[model samples]
Target: MAQNGTAESGATEERPALPLPRPVTVQEIRHTKVSERSTGARLCSCSSSVSSVRLQLCSFYKFGIKCQFRQKSKARTNTWCSPQMFIDNEWRTSSRGRTFPTFNPATGVKICDVQEADKEDVDQAVAAARAAQQRGSPWRGMDSSSRGRLLHRLADLLERDRLLLATLETLDTGKPFLQSFFVDLEGSIKTLRYYAGWADKIHGKSMPIDESFMCITKHEPVGVCGAIIPWNFPLLMFMWKIAPALSCGNTVVIKPAEQTPLTALHVGSLIKEAEFPPGVVNIVPGFGSTAGAAIASHKDIDKVAFTGSTEVGQLITEAAAKSNLKRVTLELGGKNPCIVFADCDLQMAVEEIQKGAFYNQGQCCTAASRVFVEETIYEEFVHRSIENAKKIVIGDPLDPQTSHGPQIDRQQFDKIMDLIESGKKEGARLEYGGRAVGEKSLFIQPTIFSSVKDHMRIASEEIFGPVQCIFSFKSQKEAIERANNSQYGLVSAVFTASMDRALSVSAALETGTVWINCYNALHTQTPFGGYKMSGNGRELGEYALAEYSEVKTVTIKLSETI
Candidate 1:
């Protein structure tokens, strides 16, 4: 864990501008000089504080990449991370020869022009993916062990380019540099390696049967996978979908969110450097209505995995259903609850819950938007939470000292502010920060509301911002009831010292994952998904391999003489 004390040091450096392929109105990519910050959220004192809030994960879970995480790494001194689409192992402009501007949310400045992929581009990508995974294709004929090595190579490439990817992540999405470096990039590397190890291990099994016949169950790839990743964690989600899908010998057509495509596009360059076979992994960056909808409705695409809003998930599912009934897996929005009991560690709960609430500027689907605390400790929890919220230094994502960064874009900023205003109108007391912070950027203060009612929009709706609502509960039953009242069932936590209360409450909660005394502590080994409206299918661990695999049963007739 990292220490909370703030500090300042010496000089800093920036990556020189890389030449663009084409001319367009581009803002000077601004990278400010600042003190060298420890690549950890200054919230703990553990030895491996860089791993963010995964409390028990001290190191990178023994993946042996510890040495790669150096003290300070600047963006690579190289060419610009191109915006061209990666299909058939080559970078090219869209079919329509059009481009769109992606901005740095922190400064509200245009970063660069990206090729805008539409339905035509999606068709090209899906076609490439389909051809790559066909019966006689090189990708399909490659041995599983070789595929695993390729994935490991991809992981190594990502590790080597960590600084570049992290910088691009921060520049595009407006997440803190430290977070982009230690949390997102580290997680992406770890996930790739994890799935890499699973590549050869995914196999078929022969089972006992009647004497006259033999039965075999073979696990085969689901063919071309259509992935539509969310913007909040671009690098992580990019790896999340591709790691497992590719590990299981499936080709992918990924549509990265339009808001934060820089890092994914950068990863595409790394994929080329890693020497992946053509069309094994393709990234198309565009809006949901075009690229995303195309991925969902493309009949040639065998499966579609999405991580975004519940509404979008439904649309994708409907499209998939209408077109050849493609298999769909969604990791959608959540209004997760953090239930704090009287017997819990107040300070720890306050800090952890607030971290979950405000991390990624509260744009995460699993944001701890609702908090139900026992009345005995509600006031104290709110007080400490507000104090901690004040400690979040919101500023330019490039600044090392800054902890919280801006929201994704102006639309998200306005949505969050509008929700905060709705909280005020609905009679919830604004206990702390509740408005936009910086004038030019998309940064919003970590807002907290107290005396929240269950029916209020702030409590029921997925705010997807740094807005937290705290409500009081009289007893364990009331707390459980209130926490389970939302349409989302992604994740929830029970804060308590009593094992009995913790176990009972966690079991009773209508959530896919329930933590005891922690919030948003996810691991690569954990199978993460949701129930009810939060969507279906797991994203990590052994279970995720199932999402990209299909079962084939073969029966062989034995000779009668036998």
Candidate 2:
């Protein structure tokens, strides 16, 4: 390996490609936060098998850090302000002087207070974004190549601060520390680098026309962009909104979900460290009703991108239409499906479906909430799924060995418990694991319900928790129909050994994205969105760049034939 994260041949070592250097395991992370006192551990022996959840560990496993564990934990430390808003590359107290506390969901304790941005704070942020995007400003006048270089620098800063960012993420959201580090942190870094490569590549094309006339189409920035991110994957959503918008030469005023804002706040300081022009990116942490409403209705914000519930998505659309009719894109709620055929690889189906259903404690919008298994193998699949769910270790998120964590808060916990109760009332077979795990905190047992009917509330509604409902189908047509019979059309999976069955069923499905034999496989290189009421527009890939841009047609009449 090279010193600067570049590949070097003749080193005789094989490792996964990464933009930056990372430690071999969670134990190697030298920070003194959630994870306890570190002990000396051996270098990797190249025996750690790589998985989706261990993307960071795959890079240089030969340098082992030992089997990770905790001795004691200290107070939280960070590189940014908590009780102030980040605007114009500076941290400032809210003009309204109001502050709100963010909690550690795993412990049910308050982490710290954060500035609460309402309409006043949002106005200031919007003004800053507008100023930064003005024709003569540093951000607007900078060369596209320079813009790309800035994004690259930002990625580097994020990589350098990856440990702190992951700690903050787990501290605020109650996600397992390994998940915060290997999955969410790695995903965010990859997204930033991907968009950085695209910063200078966005271009317009000439049009064919008469010899005396010339025509061309240009993709221009949509000016100031307003982003309202969700709490489930705060840091990932934060980068998803800003990377493409910034690459397209647009300024952004982002309102991260108040429930989880620490990582976003830390990244705000990172934006400054990356040497981005002042006001190019602003972060205001507050409630959706206040800061979110202001951004949706602000005429100065040229476009808005939001990720949340379908109901909230509707409100944003209404607010946008009632104001300046600014362009908008939404990544919203989903009750996605997975169909397992009789001939499918039974073990793979169970594992992938469980992962899709339970990862992030099932807070994902693309969670595999609904599963339609062929009747012949439905009972066995359900058995294997319950066994797999039993392996999840639920406890303090800071414990690297813990695979499951608490719900975001009391409300989410209550909602999930209520849905489980509803499933029992609706006569679904409670196969295994229901109810809360521990007292005080918000940990819910990995729940599974078989013999689920399509009309059951647990089957129909977006539970947004680690609960899986399995429905059995008699035929291929029935399985496809049952999977398609939902208000949401976000993503779906079909598990079968036959390629013809995979292709045919994938094509017939009404979802935006389809997985052949896998589930929840997302890449920054591919676009992801929904088909029906799930929401409009896409995130990630070349498709996301379109959401932050405007197409203008230029035509000229030639003075004379050339």
Candidate 3:
């Protein structure tokens, strides 16, 4: 059994307060500096009881030399970093001259003012993409190797400015700095590099025919791609869609979610630095109703690739069909399942469950929101899970020590709270953590609900919050049935000592990706998409390259037989 305070005992110790040489104001602290003493200088000693004297001495050192200091000024609240949208070959805003305020959920403070693109912007972006697809455009006749070089260069630039990108992502989306830096940014670089390596390698096989005939096949770019990315992994998902699509010789009209558009706009600058031909890559940041709808249904767009909610995915599908019957790839919502067996490692299981549920505040579509534990270890697993949840440090994302941060915005925070209340009203036991934590932030406690039925809303529907619902299962058969009972089939996980049981249970789960003894693991080399209502087509890997290309067969008759 795990000890109750095992996790809390390892809490990071607070740093000791240091007394400065002088009494300096808060403004001076911002610009304070230090210098090394000369070799012959004698050390000055002070008694611990003389606290004020020590402070004065520190201030004397600070002011004695030419040192940098900060001046106390009015708090610059309500500050924003406004970045313009990139359309065609130009940086422009909506024709209607409208904008939306994007807030930082950590402080409920406005981080930036984003342009709210309307129909005019979307149409112009699509037209530019179409123009780029024409014969005379730079992208039209570009060789695969050259395209690969451009993408590789872009990856290099991203790596160089990773810290800046990480800060921007943290400020805009409220994700932890380390998470955004290591996970999101690293994944994006790997994704771009992976696709870059594939650029020159993609080829179509020739079909064998009778000796009297000659036949050949080719894969050509789809042209004029419309990419709609969600806010959760804003820059990462954008790279996932655009890197492969553009590397495969397609022009893109990308529409980033309005709430977190900074990183995508920053990417536009990177694209320019990469020297990608104008119109080959365009971005329009705005509301889903105007910019998103316009791009999805645009007659000129040859294909549409989207990552977001199932409801919105359905709407995009309908719009595509109604307008131009555009080729569509949708990576939508998921209510993923994670099964824990009695013989599994309890410690590792608890850790994976914590990461699966609380990473990104459970906004990820592949997060393990539901857990089905074997009856033999149900109570113990539940207890350990609650203990682990309490140890999760939730606070400002800017703090490097913070493990989890607030949800994307006020609306998402309120929706998650409502679902938690519903789970209580619907008779699920609130095991732990069912409230917000900070006053200035929208942080929600990592919540767990026990005794949840398979049909309950908390178990069946996609809550998309840090809520874990646990169900007990008596047998493998029952576990498989319960896991397969969801309308979503995006991802599933199983933990067991027996390899046979792990493989057996994974095989029976209806999800597209099944993890054994793990949860929410991803790679750029792997294909990711869901079965059933989880949406269609795969992103990443070679399959994603195929998504942007059309296969064509050519045939010829020989003049004479061999």
Best by lDDT: 2
Instruction: Give one digit per residue, the lDDT tens place, for model 1 in 259-369.
Output: 888778767756665667888888899999988998999999999999999999999999999999999999998989988999899999999999899999998988999
Ranking by lDDT: 2, 1, 3
CA lDDT of each prediction against the hidden true structure: 0.82, 0.84, 0.81
Per-residue error for 527 in candidate 3, Å, reads 0.3
Which one wins by TM-score: 1 or 2? Answer: 2
Q: Is candidate 2 or candidate 3 better by TM-score?
A: 2
What lDDT does candidate 1 reach at residue 434? 91
Judging by lDDT, tell me the better candidate of 2 and 3. Answer: 2
Instruction: Tell me model 3's lDDT, rounded to 2 decimals.
Output: 0.81
Clashing residue pairs in candidate 2 are 43-64, 44-62, 44-63, 44-64
Question: TM-score for every candidate vs. truth?
Answer: 0.86, 0.87, 0.86
Measured by TM-score, how close is model 2 to the native structure? 0.87
How far off is residue 559 in model 2, in Å? 1.1
Give one digit per residue, the lDDT tens place, for model 3 in 282-331: 99999899899998889989999999999999999999999999999999
* Candidate 3: residue 467 Cα off by (Å): 0.5
Worst 10 residues of 1 by lDDT: 54-63
Q: For candidate 3, which ten residues in a row score worst on lDDT?
A: 35-44
